[model samples]
Target: MEDLLRPIYQERASDRDTLGILLIEKTRPNSPLTDDFDVILLIIVEDNEDQPWHVKHYEFDDKTAALHVVTEELLMQWIDTSSYRRAVEWVIYGKVIFDRNEYISDLKEQLRSFPSVKRDLRKAIEFGKLVKSYSEAKDLYETLHFKDAYSRMINSLHYLARLAVIEKGFHPEVTVWQQVRYIDPEVYKLYEELTESNEDIEKRVQLMILAIDFVISTRARYSAKHLLDTMGEREGSWSYSELKTHPYLLSYGLDLTAIVSYLAEKNIIKTERVETKGVGVYQRKYLVTDKE
Candidate 1:
């Protein structure tokens, strides 16, 4: 692998701005680790001329390599948001072909530690997905759209599996089920029951709705810690609009309505009714309450 990438390594070895360059070889015969390429060269730079990342394909020694040029900032964003699960795997498992001041090494250590703030944020993002998908699935099921409801339930389960893994102090990998099975077997069992049941899809869907409600009810408050914590940053309550557009939540890509409604409904957060312009109407604002 070094022989194949020696050119890339030598070319940037002298560049002061180039902080780190790591190599990841495809782990399996049909691995998508390198997007089906034989190898990947992840170049971490201080800056990329205002571009977050750039990609190029090259033929090296009759094999393919995908070279990814990314800034350290954007790479950290990816890690924080779980935007690219494969990128997390790369950071954890990729080989350090070159390093300046142990940049990649320290990053791997941080990710392994799994800071509370990142965990809370990731859980919020994944939980937002879980709630929205499950709500849509419930609506579809009530309207007798069994097929579509089943599809939505699958998506909800996927999010649930991710949450389970994140709460267990690990980022959800590309193969999410593999992590969930050991971290939280009950959630994995729900996945198995929904997907591999011998019963008809409708029946499976029917059963999962009840099971899902229980799980969501239990996880709602803890899963929403990131948002709840944000709301606590100030003294006054926050309107839906304020909470949605808050800078702290800008990168979470969350479903604000679903999360806030669930939190309010559960009394995890209190509601304040402010009079609206119209005579008989009120605008609801949310306040952070005792989080015991």
Candidate 2:
């Protein structure tokens, strides 16, 4: 493997700040994400504030090499959030062509550990996104936007499937539905109802929306426990902006106000009005209730 990759590395010897190289071989035929590429080369580099790494692709004869240039910080972020599970898998299973002071080996160990905090944070974030998508679909449907509602509901189901997989302690892959089918068959069934049912479009969408609502009611609080825990960190209530800007919560693309509203409605959290000096007469603050 090293000999095969030596030429590629030597070709880019002038490129500085490279920490290591990872070579991921194609193990399965017709891989969905690989685009028939024979191998994937991931080059991990030190974060450079002056210049960002540029990605390149190359092909030789019947073989193809797809090059991905990622900074160490970005790579760690992806691992923590499980945003790029396949990439992390490659780092774990791929052959390391070279490393600067064993950095790549240490990084592989980190991926192997899969810390629980990152897992919980990732699950909470995904759950928040799923709820937000479901709410959007419901609002669109109520406004008589059937076509848009259908599209948004389908999007919600995708997030729902991902959240289900995350809840099971597995990082969802690009083929999320396939994973969800085995991990959470109920969500798969709902998806089939939406896509395969002979019912009218509106009725099918409505049925899916109902299923989403049931899921939100039953699972939202538990899935979002990480966010709720952060909200209760201080004795004072948390404002929407504060929660939205939270370091841990920001990466999930969460709808903070929507989540707070849902939690309030479910009596998991309570909202209070606090007068502010400049922003407004009063601002809504969310607080964890005893029920939480």
Candidate 3:
């Protein structure tokens, strides 16, 4: 492997005359020789099966100038095709490693896993673009629950997103969810609810309808438990603080204390804490007395 790669290393190190001949002679196995070492290396990476497919041209260049010159075209090809998978795996494995106090070992693992995801992602994006040409992916539900018929369409969008990540070297796992929230918060919320409930298609659809109605009617001011109760009855009352403590509230980001402060500031619902002489101070759940 080293001997096969030695020529490429030597070509860059040797003068333009000798380097040019060797690169050209090497291309006799193929066709269309040119002055560009860039073309030569590309062919080598693509056509040379004995060498690893994912090897970057810069591995030969230890200096900044040579590395930058050699990588100008090849880098873009890799970025366009393979970067997403590399970035994502880096984030996932990096996070897991740092969490375990084994950062060094994890870093080495990242170096290895990084290339596979890139190669896969590039292929995925190409596959996605081909699929997107024939179908449409207009919304979150289509991309999520109805992935069967629109699999290609969804894949295309995912691949495109991955491609962007690869180009930018960004890895935000919440990014996809944040995109859903922006595009369709109601639909996103419904998806979260249904996923948590583990309901079937019919149940999920029905729940989605209720969630839409909930978002439209009440401004999403109630806790999950209160939301369920309100859906069941169309009207109910409870104290703000007590609603926060409800067991189901974990499904949302709200905790008991934060819920009270938020509801009071928003004025979405009225609050009351009932103090009974024998029972002591008991906080009731918040009730939606009015809707604006």
Candidate 4:
């Protein structure tokens, strides 16, 4: 394996920005999990104020390699947001071929720590996505777009599994269903109901929607506490535009308005109307209350 990987490592090392290299070997034969690649190499580079990363593929002497160039900043973002579960798995399972000042090892340690704040923030973000997808699915169903609603429900189930894993203080892995099945069977049952139930298509969709609604009502406040905390960071209330552009929240691709509305409905947060300069001009702002 080293003989096959050495040349690739040498090639990447020529780039001055290269900081570390991780080599993940395929141990199972004909396994779909490997994505049909013999080797997966992650080349980590310093933030050079350029594009985050790129991919390269190679085939030589009957060997296949998938090369991924990732910036350290982007890597940390993936870790914090749980966006790149496969990359995180590679970090844990791959062998470090080379490192500049142990940067790779340190990153692995950081992931191992699994800080509470990061965990909570990621869970909140995932839950927010779950709610958004569920809402979209319901809208599609009401419009008689049954197929589209089914697809959206599947997306919602994916987010639900991720949220469940994050709730247990673990980074979600690539096989989210497998992980959720063992860790949180209640959440797993929702997936089963959507996919494997014997009910009619519309009935299944309705049941799944109802299940998701219950989850949103019970879990939204606790799962979204991080977002609420960000809103309370300032003494004054935050406008819709302000929260929409918040740097941290931006990473999650959240529907700020939907989240704010959900919290308002739950009475966990209150909205106030602030008048603008023009006559009858007003904007809505949100803030967490002491009762919340």
lDDT per prediction?
0.89, 0.78, 0.37, 0.83
Clashes of 1: 0
How would the candidate models be sorted by TM-score, starting from the highest? Answer: 1, 4, 2, 3
lDDT digits (tens) for residues 1-292 of candidate 4: 6787788788777777888898887888864435678888899998656579788898878878888889988988888876776788888888998888888899888777778889878877887788788889999999988889999999999998998888887788878899999999999999998899998788889888888899878888788878887877878888877888888688555566677778888888888889999899888888787536
Q: On a 0 to 100 scale, what is the lDDT of residue 78 in model 4?
A: 82
- Candidate 4's C-alpha runs over 4 A off are 11-17, 29-34, 49-51, 277-281
What C-alpha root-mean-square deviation, in Å, does candidate 3 show against the real structure? 19.1
- Give a tens-digit lDDT track for model 1, residues 1-292: 6786888767876788899888999878898777889998888899878688998898867888988888989898899888887788888889998899988889889999999989999999998889899999999999999999999999999999999999989888988999888999999999999999999988999999999999999998899989988888889889888987888787654688888887888898999999989998999999987855
Question: lDDT value for candidate 1?
Answer: 0.89
TM-score of each: 0.96, 0.84, 0.23, 0.90
How far out, in Å, is residue 4 in model 2?
A: 4.2
lDDT per residue for candidate 2 within 108-227, as digits (tens), equals 776556466776787676777777888888899999898889998889888788788777777677789999989999999999999899998889888888888998789877777778
Model 3 agreement with the true structure over 233-272: per-residue lDDT tens digits: 4466655444445543432322334334444555655656
Clashing pairs in 3: 81-122, 82-118, 238-285, 238-286, 238-287, 239-284, 239-285, 239-286
Poorest lDDT segment (10 consecutive residues) of candidate 1: 247-256
Candidate 2 TM-score, true structure as reference: 0.84
